[model samples]
Target: TQLLEQSPQFLSIQEGENLTVYCNSSSVFSSLQWYRQEPGEGPVLLVTVVTGGEVKKLKRLTFQFGDARKDSSLHITAAQPGDTGLYLCAGDKSGGSNYKLTFGKGTLLTVNP
Candidate 1:
């Protein structure tokens, strides 16, 4: 089974702080994606890092993929109340009828105003 485990299942902090979340797995995947979901809306794709050891930056967020393609990490430069949401890391495997993604349980982040 291709399962991705995320660390710090829950996090709470004051506004204007920094935090890093990790996702690790024993299975290899073709690509990894990070998403942030707000209250009612669906998860929004934050970044997608394909190459091993690859890193991508989006505003105040940085995402990195492991060299073995089995792990990934997300670092937020300065978290805000607006950043409060569910952070999920997903992996895309090769075999699947549709573009299916295996999502982690998710890390719930709460940024106090």
Candidate 2:
């Protein structure tokens, strides 16, 4: 089984709406990262949460790490057409040695203008 599971594999909303995506895992991770990817491009990191119970925000996006460091959530307010993309969550368990990331399948979001 995949280490990370993302909910709402796909989402469709109108501009100005709000949405939330979730990533969950039963195993603990040293760090978790959120990324957004556009069509024909790679995923760009949006936020990285290393500390448990940590929260980070970027513009209209909010990211939170679970207190146990096993899960994370992403919230986006006032969604825009530009916000449409593939949202991905990845977890790192390397003890500062190998830099391998376990990525979730990804959540696809589509915002209609």
RMSD in Å for all candidates: 1.7, 0.7
Give per-residue CA lDDT, model 1, range 28-55, as digits (tens): 9889999999989899998988999999
lDDT by residue for model 2 over 1-113, one digit each (tens)?
88899998999999999999999999899999999999999999999999999999999999999999999999999999999999999999884876799999999999999
Give the range of the ten consecutive residues with the poorest summed lDDT in model 2. 92-101
Q: Give the TM-score of each candidate.
A: 0.93, 0.97
Report lDDT (Cα) of residue 113, candidate 1.
Answer: 87
Q: What's the count of clashing pairs in each model shown?
A: 0, 0
- Which prediction has the highest TM-score against the true structure? 2
| Error in Å for residue 18 of model 2 | 0.9
* Displacement of the residue 28 alpha carbon in candidate 2, Å: 0.3
Q: Could you tell me the C-alpha RMSD of candidate 2 in Å?
A: 0.7
lDDT of 1 at 100: 77
